[model samples]
Target: MQRSLLLRCSNSIFRPPPNSHRLRPPSLKRQSAPIAASSGAQLPLTFSQNYRTAPNRLHCSVSESQWKQDREMATADEQQDPRIARISSAIRVIPDFPKPGIMFQDITTLLLDTKAFKDTIDLFVERYRDKNISVVAGVEARGFIFGPPIALAIGAKFVPMRKPNKLPGEVISEEYSLEYGTDKMEMHVGAVEAGEHALVIDDLIATGGTLCAAVKLLERVGVHVVECACVIELLGLKGRERLGDRPLFVLVNST
Candidate 1:
């Protein structure tokens, strides 16, 4: 049954019901608010507030009015961008997942859509392809999914920041705090050298702990982190603030 549902969803990737486009929430828009990065520059990218209700509820505490004004600011051009709508619609939101009161932004559905998955990598590649990035570091697990394609597309070497005991080599580690306890991320020794610029890629950002640890690990090895990028950002959690000055760039914002 689960497999059939996924297959149906995948098959309908490019076909939407008549006037379905009109029902899509506000299109993507560039954020006026600056997200600080290593260069102290602002990224001109889309930022939208996504609010989902019952059937596929979002466990967000914030009210919708607070973000309604921002949604209204979306430009006509942004609203017309097919990639934004396609990508946004492909994501599957699961309520009470992994525990109660949690809204998980599942990208497995998005991955099943060939065009959507390619667009995901294309967007990141278009942003970093000419930025002189030498290394692309991906956090364990999900990061392993989105990182390699972007790394390969941008002509950069892929570095995996793994969980403890996963890397079979001399490694360096950084311990980070989690909601329940603490965890550590390890990187192979000498994988990156001084004077190299890196971009950290992950699937999503909630509290930003994992990305922070990845940044710290790379910086500890004298690598200059260019910025951190993710496919989704849970605005309600304010994970962006946890990264300090390292800038964060994301494709979709959810609450």
Candidate 2:
């Protein structure tokens, strides 16, 4: 059988292997363990377990109909938060453009729907508005879109982590390995003050090279990275494991 595609593209970004044909179930042995969000609400153990086992994953077998039902249920729960459903629906997927057999999650479609796009920003804004974050560091160039809006809403400064030589100022850079090759990300020196709390933003997390590089750059400068936030997480790639102990939050989990 031909492999399925999973594309992660926004300006310059990473892509996961094109083989996420099914959504894997979490292990059945553990008793319920609650994972708390910033709102003090408990998230399900399945979501918690999946989030905790980043860079590594657990898969289980189930009938096709049952898997379909599970996905439908997950979608229904996301719709309970109207904004999430809107955002997910607005994203478009393109196949075989950058290369054959690649399924790309295209945010450009989401950007076209003004209401959906605004709601996406509003949802993040509402969540982090009171989190006391001082700097919102966005990875170029999609993060450029999502970060500034959230920063402005929350009264925090927006910092851009750019590609090598993209920033003209005295900048610090970190080199990270990608599935294709190595890439370097740079941040302007003094853009953030020491001991400030920061939140890292990106459009997607695939193998997590870019997000990991962004976090490393921030920590090397003495900035505390409170969390990493993305619009989508390609769960099959297990990017979360590469991020160490920092909590990861996403609006959509695409398997």
Candidate 3:
């Protein structure tokens, strides 16, 4: 029964109904404890367990209606933002990209549209501007694209959280789980100082593993991560839940 429910949830996320641009919320609720595996079954490792073990985490209890209303208000706000439409339309979806059973949200197309790309950065800048954000920590690769511009616009330093030995100086690293193994994200030791306000930037949030790792990396150095911002969010994955009390801001929800 559990397997069936998991399969159904996956299907609902990746296989939306025809003519549907928005995804309906999945029916499966999140389990508090890890599900027990059947005999001889090997369960995949997840980052949620590790995230929960961290100290001083803030937990909130929000009612379902309140959560829905908050989401609705956010959506309405996006609708009012002129950049939202252009950013959403410029993104291209490629089926079975990088692997089968994946519907990849491609942002390269958005990069090609100069106006849309600028609008994307401008939207982020508007939010962080005058918020006293001093450090913009961008996760590797795609984060590199959006982070620099926002950092420059907001008069903040751009810190790169890279993979493995990408950085030349002394660095600190945080590792997170993958399907078959684990991966690490590293940051320069002195790139940011204690008590500095930070904002984490990434292109997308699926299972939240990368963003979670980024947060942990920043926090280790005593940086206060104001919030995480992504270009697109896969709503069915419930990545927001993995972030605990850290708020997430996104321009598009590809449910």
Candidate 4:
């Protein structure tokens, strides 16, 4: 019975319902507010938020083409945030492990680096702390690594979304597709109360089927899914597109 449900869900992946919105990658909007560090915090010397070019300054005068070139260079430089670079560097990539031609983004390397792992959780905690999230629902396995810390830091309940039959009592499950087959994810029947706001956490999103199933399961139980968060995103697969209207946040994007 579970297998049949998963098969049906897998079929729906190819045929998205009409009127679904195309999911675009999240954009970082530059804030006009001046960047300021916390009290006693030392800012990175290489980058300065106070740096500005004025028309009156001798070095500020440039032709239109040069100005455009400078702007492009600045944009490129902005993409390499020091924190993100550290996090990305710690991830180990293994090629063709499960199969040929697949480059896996392994977070175990990040986990090994104590500083990097704490930073990973700290980043998520800082983002969600002020969002009033009542529950942090973590996807099975990898999500467990990141979820509890964030839940504890943000003062929210941690709910584990598990595989079929993993939960002891009555459970609600959602079937989703994988590259080879379909699988079902389950959550305890009373893990979350109706109208509670939740955030879903996962290590990465490849095709987004697991995250989608998670959202469906939570919503089915009347919990409001505020957003989905992941540590990394595989860009070429375009998994973000599969999640319609659901906001996704990730620390790193890799090919």
Residue 199 CA error for candidate 4 (Å)? Answer: 0.5
Question: What is candidate 1's TM-score against the reference?
Answer: 0.72
Tens digit per residue, CA lDDT, model 3, 150-237: 9999999999999998999998999987655788889988899999999999998776778899999999989899989988776545
**lDDT against the true structure, each candidate:** 0.66, 0.68, 0.68, 0.64
lDDT of 4 by residue, 1-255 (tens): 000000001111122122121222236222122212223332221101111111110111234565345334433533644566667667665433345334456678799888889888988888899998999999988999999999999999999999988889998889876645668999988899999999999998666777788999999989899889988765334466667667787776543
Per-prediction TM-score to the true structure, in the order listed = 0.72, 0.72, 0.74, 0.69
Give the per-residue lDDT of model 2 (tens digit) for 97-129.
355334466688788889989988887787788
Worst 10 residues of 2 by lDDT: 46-55
The per-residue C-alpha lDDT of model 4 at residue 220 equals: 91
Model 4: worst 10 consecutive residues (lDDT sum): 1-10
Quote the lDDT for 221 in model 1. 84
Give me the runs in candidate 1 sitting further than 4 Å from their true place. 1-77
Judged by lDDT against the true structure, how good is candidate 2? 0.68
With a 3 Å backbone cut-off (N, CA, C), the pairs that clash in candidate 3 are none
Positional deviation of 189 in candidate 4, in angstroms? Answer: 0.6
Which pairs clash in the backbone of model 4?
Answer: none
